[model samples]
Target: MTLLSSCTRAARISAAVIALLACGSVLLQIGLNLLGGEPLAEALWRMSRFFTILTNLIIAATFAVVAGGRSVAPRWLLAMTAAIAGVGIVYHALLSHLLVQVGAEIIANHGVHTVVPILSVIWFAMFAPVDGLRWRDTWTVVIWPVLYCVYILARGSVTGMYPYPFIDANTLSPVQMAINIAGLTLFFLALGLLLVGMLRLRGRKSAN
Candidate 1:
């Protein structure tokens, strides 16, 4: 097989592994929740939840990149994934006090050590081609947010836990919730565009 095809296969394989890991982690979280019987149950639950969230976030990006990144170029994906990750870092690092409390504790209780995002970092390097970045790569990173938001909404309604306070449509008016969602989506989209632009430039250079 050609190098490109091999890389694509590897990426899809990684995504499959990641999806399994993420989904399994969810079951593990449920177990931990049930195990609240143990003294360290909360901590375990938190750790499981953290890992689950982190992996799902990163793996979703991987799927997005793997499925779409090839349409353009590898470098475009690499650059965009990096940018998307940066946006995530900024969002988590600089969240407002209200946003954090608004249900943030639920997600925070999960093991949020430096390791959570580590799983995702590899996707950008391993899956994204070293050659060129493209507009499509940006769209791949977005899969995480879009899918995750839906998961959170559904799970929250079932579990009585909103991952973040801002997302709690239960208390907030639908308008307020919509506003928050729209605002956050825009921010993520902007980040994706920037990443794509950066990758596209990199691709242009490699060809010369």
Candidate 2:
């Protein structure tokens, strides 16, 4: 096969693997929640509160399409790469010490937060298309996270349950919660810019 064809095949295979890993990890987490006596509806709702779960679900869907030999918009793929990068970085830096897990929970946790993120970023860097990315596309990265912050805050006002400690309404003053959300939004923006920069650098190299 030509090198381009080889890369395309490799990208599709990688996408398939990532899709399976993400989907399986999410299903495993849900099953564990159900087995632990959480009602199915409640379990799913609780999972939706987490950025890790949502981002992984996005990864699963995006990559599944690529694996199916369909083209995804480059901007959407770029946004997803930024979001998942945030999930992994934030989890390791701020949230990793807060959790204790064993057995299947451990697998699910690492699969979504660590394994999927690492693989997704690698796939993007090595194989995913970057020819259409632009600096303005960085804005798209924060759209989902900003909406999620609004959602969790709105839902927490009624339910009094926040998914992450940083955003907990009961525990944090409004000012502090706002600061945390602002910081996270900035982080996502930074990640998005960094990816765009990488694309520009690659483009320059290819032009020479």
Quick one: best lDDT, which candidate?
A: 2
Which regions of candidate 1 are displaced past 4 Å? 1-87, 95-127, 130-133
Worst 10 residues of 2 by lDDT: 1-10
Model 2's alpha-carbon lDDT is: 0.87
Q: In terms of TM-score, which candidate is strongest? A: 2
Root-mean-square deviation of each candidate, in angstroms?
A: 7.6, 3.1
> What 10-residue stretch in candidate 1 is worst by lDDT?
108-117
lDDT by residue (tens digit), candidate 2, 49-145 = 8989998999999999888887787778888999999999999999999999999999999999999999988888777555677798789999889
Clash count, candidate 1: 12
lDDT of 1 by residue, 1-208 (tens): 1224636566667655654554454455455556556556665545433323554445455454454434434543443444345434644565433343324334432322122334445565444444444465455555555565677777677777775666885788888988877776666677667555654555567689
Give the CA lDDT, 0 to 100, for residue 86 in model 1.
45
TM-score of each: 0.52, 0.92
